[model samples]
Target chain A: MSINEKDELLYNMENRDVETPQPRVKRGGVHRPFLFGFATALCLVYLMDLGFEAYKFATLRETVQVASGELQTSWPPPPPYTEVARVARYVVHISDWASLATISTAAPIKGFPFANTASVSDGPVGLSSGTPYFYISNLDFTGKDLLTDARTTVSLSEAQSDYCHTSGFDPEDPRCARILLSGSIVEVKNGTEEATFARTALFSRHPVMKTWPIGHHFFFAKLNISHIYVLDFFGGASDVSVQDYYKATPFP
Target chain B: MSINEKDELLYNMENRDVETPQPRVKRGGVHRPFLFGFATALCLVYLMDLGFEAYKFATLRETVQVASGELQTSWPPPPPYTEVARVARYVVHISDWASLATISTAAPIKGFPFANTASVSDGPVGLSSGTPYFYISNLDFTGKDLLTDARTTVSLSEAQSDYCHTSGFDPEDPRCARILLSGSIVEVKNGTEEATFARTALFSRHPVMKTWPIGHHFFFAKLNISHIYVLDFFGGASDVSVQDYYKATPFP
Candidate 1:
């Protein structure tokens, strides 16, 4: 097409909403196969969302059935201050959510720290990997902050788990155990095995994550930790080397 | 004095428990009135502890007396998402703990972001100041981080409050509300009105703060917030100006 015709076609496409489908769209010489593929992808995404909702419903039904019979939940966690590496790994595994702190790069408040209550998991239920994953959107300040400075911290407290609350350990007490780490945050490229694993780890613990608005452009990011500082006793923070953090098992 | 005499004196002091009354504690050349004054101070402190225990016992009895007549607590938080300033203030006031995010400057992890699970309060009970205060010990990583880089962020979620859990709002939902702030963390000088306010605000919410070890060199700190971002509803963060944030009345 000539330049004038191309400009006219682009203007029409830009102004038109999806609901205002143009029967004459192909008249601008746009190909049919491209539109067909785009439409198919959209339908598949919708179907996947529906499938996820159905799965959650079934899971909730099973949980309710189980709860009616027994009110107690099977909480398995190591005693606080037992061993530094082991406790750190166990807290990371069982805690469903934590605040992710990052250095801000936003206008006028740049370089300050920012934190958000985040849905996080190291691996799927009953499987501990010692690495926390996040599914986040760029629309959020945290996502933008990570892009500018990927040095991040994920701090988890055993108070987040029912075991601590039930055992009468107050959150501020050192005996409740807390883990703080400094790490590098990196985005998981779409269409990769790590991305898949990240999604599974997050969604299994926080099923609502699967239903967040798609327009937000959610992506998975993982923190590769270099330092681990834990507090589980009165004297001082526990001596947990990064080498010990990753290799330690979540359970005895 | 001979070295053996000095050693003997030290051994006697160490071997004698608190129950043993030394007829000649001054025989080792220790002053008499100094030791007596110290013992008197210790006894006064113990008596004060007993008084506090009695006060708590009476308070518990009063609460039990009141509970017989009412099934609900007199919690007076504004309905979630009612007004931006009011809700933000309420969350900060009612939340006993939040994650304090600071730019790390500690050795081996300098310049990275660090988060610590912190106990916080905005004001003494029922009087919301719309500013969060922290009682922190310099021995903790967060305290050290803030000292080097006072720029900090405090993120709070309504999930920390019973409002969300009772109303069936998920912690991650926008309706559950969240607050993000960037500010400078400064030590509240002792004997200042703000320091008194900080202590009152903190101790009233986190009663355990009053009992934390004194050797840790705890201090009162408050975030002089420059920016406030609040998410109380679906579209995006509410446009809450700093002046509005400070002056906004907590409730009618």
Candidate 2:
């Protein structure tokens, strides 16, 4: 065909919109064979989606079951107590102001020979509360030392004197409760309502509170309680008095 | 003394109002040597209290300084870019359905002749701009497979096709960008407002949206863009059509 004719034919074909009829082929021949490409592709894609869905469902179910199990075992009642008893304790030390004057007794002096002499004025005394409470003057060296190194041991003895054979003393030579407290000394305010109640209890129970002035200090300490050790002298023989009097009660 | 005499003496002593006199000792004698107990106790106590106070003060100072430093360093400025440019390219596999049909090319048919027909009654055609977007029916096997594994690779040609040789194509012989994205497939709803915006942008760039039905299946994936190979097919030519088009107009 001529070049112009070929160009004309291409233009006619491009613009045509005629419908074509279906073709026929012999039965069971290669031309008429069934194509499995589309079916196989469809099956593979469907199977993959199903597998992913199944995996996701299983993982979610397991997580839920584990959370339920944890919730079930979290709540129960507390255990019973079988070993409860009382204990008495005390701490003694060589008075820092007057080394010769020792904390020989924690009880009231009642005009003893060493009560108010030049070498022995009324010294600050610590009570047997879980956290110790004591009176101190801003001028005393012992008070300053306690504020610095709050961790110190005080000695204790049941015997009233070095000679155990003194009258009105026990003959069996029983052991005495001794303890040491180790913690930092912090200054806290006495602004809480409970402070007044604590002061009243101190005045009624301690002779020193009644005898000496103790309300002038700017800061009082709220000690952090760490540990406690009680050495029982008479064991179970004097259980009632020892337990009731010596147990350290925590401050409010 | 007899018991009667001792009792009388004790009663008299208790009621006595007599004051005790101070004792005097010689200053230069060995018995009058200076005592160091009081001085030593005071020194020790004072040193301890001072040490504890120093420690507490140092710790508190350190904590406060650290917190202040953190607070100071936490404020600054941000960046100035508005629309960040991200280039994403991918490869996709495509399958076209064909049907057997016959018609006269130049003259009328004289005898029966066989023709190979492709099943193209109801199928899809794949296309791409920067990323390939699939449009398939729910019953298609390829669609099912994509939902299942969602992992696939496209075998691309190294030679440029007719699409890349268009009249306005900037790079004369461009090396096609090929990438394989393997990830789990998710179906997103196109009826929502966010989907509507995304669909409009996609459809505006490609005319295939007019042929595909709405709400048909499509894959949403987290694609891994990798295996990049750059070829100097266009002799390192830089395409400046986009830049020229953008710079043709003066700034407002």
Candidate 3:
């Protein structure tokens, strides 16, 4: 060993003796060996406890199971049922798709009220306009229905989400919440500012719409909401004014 | 020690000596102390491994997570998309609730197409009738609309279940599957056999309907399906005849 290293080892040994005072073992007094052993055992137990927690964290990650297709992610709680306007708007804002009902113009079942599954957006993410926009093709049934009769109603249910189903509330339960938007779906005039905004709103929510075939004669249309119907609680449906619906923020 | 125990101990020692031949450690043979230490270490490692596995299993039980509202349970995989009739029936059979669209007779928004969330059932559990039954009251918007015009459409989507969302499919995507049943809503005559069956079907699927106020004059109704529209694949929607839709088993 080098001379300096040898000196450092001697100093460390001397310092250790000074730091840990010698224990006394006498009748009616604490025993040094027993106390030392107990302290060592406690440290070992603390280390094992920490190791178990780390192991549990790893286990949780490995055992994560996806239920119904809903990833285990957290979202804001829904608004209370008393806020009819807010609940109505919240349903529209959160849903990516809904049932669009229109008077059919096509044959076989012409003039009947037809409901088709449609994807829609109120506005771009984080911007709730209370207006539902659609990107539809003239070739599809809903598109054909829209072209023939502009009058339509979009139906949205909290049941469409895990919200009601998981809460043990039946989809039809008033507390589960349902919204119906009745209005005329008008095609935005091409090249208009509203049309541009509609495209941005619909495409941002449904990215695949951007790559849809052009030959299908797809066009942008929006629901000019006239009347709002909300069923959020037991007393029956309420018709909220369009102005109040617009004034209320869905975030509330 | 007792004479008999002393003799047994002596026998055991002699047997052990005979069973375990002494290792020659003159220079190149195995050493006793080293072998004993290694064996003891191996035993401790095995016990630790077993303890770790038990700990992991306990951790898994404690950390179970519920996603969306879907309880972690196993369900059969959906039928292939090409089975148009089967897919249509499957969408109807699997859905517990759907969007019921009807022509409105109420004033203000009267004569407009109105969509309402309705809970429906095809038949009692395990009996797929390919026909949807409803429990409606004249007090509700849907019931009032039905009183005016019986023509309606019930829209069902695989999106209602976690199937589409968990599979990364948008609700509007054709592969997500949607069914539109266009038909006339006819009330089952009260006190008749059909009414009895309708009540059984509707009540079984939606238990909450049983507790709905009797004052609302809730009555049973069924859709006399005339046409079926199914969109389950990338191609355009298919027009499946009502006959084929009934003939195909949803289980297939």
Q: Which has the greatest DockQ?
A: 3
Q: Which residue pairs does candidate 3 place in steric collision?
A: A69-B166
Candidate 2 docks at the CAPRI level of incorrect
Q: What are the per-model numbers of colliding residue pairs?
A: 0, 17, 1
Residues B18-114, model 2: lDDT tens digits: 5443333223441221123233434555687699899986654332110010011111111111111111111121111111111112112111111
Best by lDDT: 3
lDDT of 3 by residue, B104-164 (tens): 8778789889888888888775577888988888998989898878889888888776677
lDDT accuracy of residue A252 in candidate 3: 43
Lowest lDDT block of 10, candidate 1 chain A: A64-73
Better of 1 and 3 by TM-score: 3
Q: Tens digit of lDDT per residue, candidate 1, span A1-252?
A: 999999988987887766496663244564343345445545665687699999986654333110001121234556447678988887788766678888777776777788887767899867888889988788887888887888888888765444444444556767778888778888889899988899898877666677888999988988888888888878778768988888898777
Query: Which residue window of length 10 is worst by lDDT in model 3 chain A?
Result: A64-73
lDDT of 1 by residue, B1-252 (tens): 899999988988887765486663354564444444445545665687699999986554332110000011234555447488777776666666678888787777887788888777788767888788888888888888776778888888766544554444556667777888778888889999988888898776666677788888898888898888888888877757888788776555
Q: For each candidate in the order shown, give its overall lDDT on alpha carbons.
A: 0.72, 0.27, 0.78
lDDT (Cα) of model 2: 0.27
Query: Model 2 Cα displacement at B219 (Å)?
Result: 94
**Model 1 per-residue lDDT at A19:** 44
